[model samples]
Target: MKAAFAPTLEGWYERHRRDLPWRHTRDPYRIWLSEVILQQTRVAQGRPYYERFVEAYPTVTDLALADERELLRLWQGLGYYSRARNLHQTARYITEQLNAEFPATFDGLLSLKGIGVYTAAAVASFAFGERVPVVDGNVYRVLARVFGITEDITTTGAKKTFAKLASELIQPASDPATYNQAIMEFGAIQCTPVSPDCLLCPLQQSCNAYQTGRQQRLPVKAKKEPVRNRYFNYLVLRQNGKLVMRERTARDIWQNLYDFWLVETDEPITALTDLNLPDELAKLVQQGRLTGNPVPLTQLLSHQRIRGQFFLVDLPDTVSMPLPTGFGQYSMDEINQLPKPVLVTTYLNEWLG
Candidate 1:
């Protein structure tokens, strides 16, 4: 199986691989940048960000020296703010500690922030020819189905198992990078998560899932937590062209990002009229702080669905906000410059743009 694996897959890769920007490079930094951007992101969606980042910070040292706010701005709308933060930290560590060179060995690479085993393997194999296997989502699906392994792919144990299996296949290959790239591309294009092109697959005859008619069931996952619903009411305040914006410091979704005055509810409110605004906000309004109404909006995250209502308030010139420290007013220009979550950015563009 290992003897035939490389030639069979690498042949397919040579003919069918997509002409992505990162694929053309042997540079580890460029490959690392693309890998980080591609995690949990579609190729089409992440390609632009890869291009932007490459253009913005041509070198690891350049990224290391950038301000956090500026880095967050570049990473805006790329949902996982933590990845961006980790990327910045890793760049700094590499530039300052390692003389701007990515660690040559997989284990050394893993010591860097945000570079997991999979990422380490990918970079090490592709850039340094380290003869290690790369197991990402695509690889997991392909291997589980091809071999019809039933171990739930979601668990940590499954990861080591799959990585070991993948390594066995790659170790015998003439070039590990070619085989690694082939398998990943094969999984992405052939053994897809949904509605795979089984008929056209070259490995269909040998595929255990196809033989047993269990393609859909082979790559099983442990049941995740139930999808949770959350209600968020944002107070979009404006007084003499100043808008209320707060840096979200809480250890929640969009942490360290900017948002508006928020009120979270346990249950969804069908209408703004049903919601009882906080007493402090109500008292402030009565004391000539502002007058407002709600604008409905909602966004879906992986584990949670958020239904949001924006209460736009216009304050009188004489009143001042009793907002907490770190909650400040911003002009339209300043507001546009701050790093905000995608949901908040959408609202601000519609209401204040």
Candidate 2:
């Protein structure tokens, strides 16, 4: 059964694969970058980011030595900021601990900060030509449809089944890079989650779901949890052209990235007086450091909702508000050079400009 499917998929791949920049190169470092950037990101959106990362880092060593803030800044607008941080940390680990060489084996790659099972398989196969199966969302969809799988693919058992099947079906005579890409491409272009164009699919003849007329239902996914709402009041205080910003710690999203002063509440605070400003904020007002009341701004996240506030402050010539621990004060112009989360950028454009 495997023998029959391999050639057809490979032949279809050779003729129909999209011409992408990453496809043109077989460099491990480049391959790793593409895989990381593409996580939770679409091909069209990730392509420019991939090109930018390649241009900025150029090599593993360059990525290793890059400043965290600058790296985060470059990764701005691309959500899932943890990936960027992990990429930076792993690069440093490879350079400092592993002597600047990426791990050659699947296990070795998985040991890195951000590389998981799918990423490990992808990097190992695509970069090293190892015959490992790459079972990402796209591959899962294709596999489920071809095999007529109806179990929710989000389940552990389903994942294991798919992985086992993928390992068995990987083309033994073909390059792992091509095989992995072919399956991924087949899913993205033909076996899509929505109304798939089964008529044009290369696997149409052999696909079980297509034969049963249940293509849309094969790769079943579990329902998502409802997003929680959050309200944030951001204080964009300025003193002599310097804006107050702070680093998001590990406790929150956009960790290690910069943003305006954040005041979180369970529900929206309509009155400025209701927000008991911290001593620092009160001191700013008492010392005539702040000129205006708080203004509300709202931002949304995939799993969270945020309503923020901006307080434009003007400080006395001799007075300075105590900076938050672990945060540094930056002139608005200098802030432009720092890597800030997109929400911060949006706030800045509205208030600072």
> Using Cα atoms with residue i matched to residue i, what is each candidate's TM-score against the true structure?
0.64, 0.64
In the order shown, the candidates' Cα RMSDs to the true structure are 17.4, 17.9
Q: Give the alpha carbon lDDT tens digit for every residue of 1-353 in model 2.
A: 56777777778888888999998777788899999999999999999999999999998999999999999999998899999999999999888998988898899999888999999999999888888899999988888888888889889999899999999888474677788888888878777889998888878888999999988777888767677877776666666778777778867788888886676788877654565777877777566544455666666777676666666667676886677676667987888888877767886777666
> After superposing candidate 1, which stretches have Cα over 4 Å from the reference?
227-353
**lDDT, candidate 1, 49-133, per-residue tens:** 9999999998889999989899889989888999999999999999999999889999999888999988998999988999988
Q: In model 2, where is the ten-residue run with the lowest total lDDT?
A: 285-294
Top lDDT model:
1
Give the count of colliding residue pairs in each prediction. Answer: 0, 4
So what's the TM-score on candidate 2? Answer: 0.64
Q: Please identify model 2 stretches exceeding 4 Å from their true place.
A: 171-173, 226-353
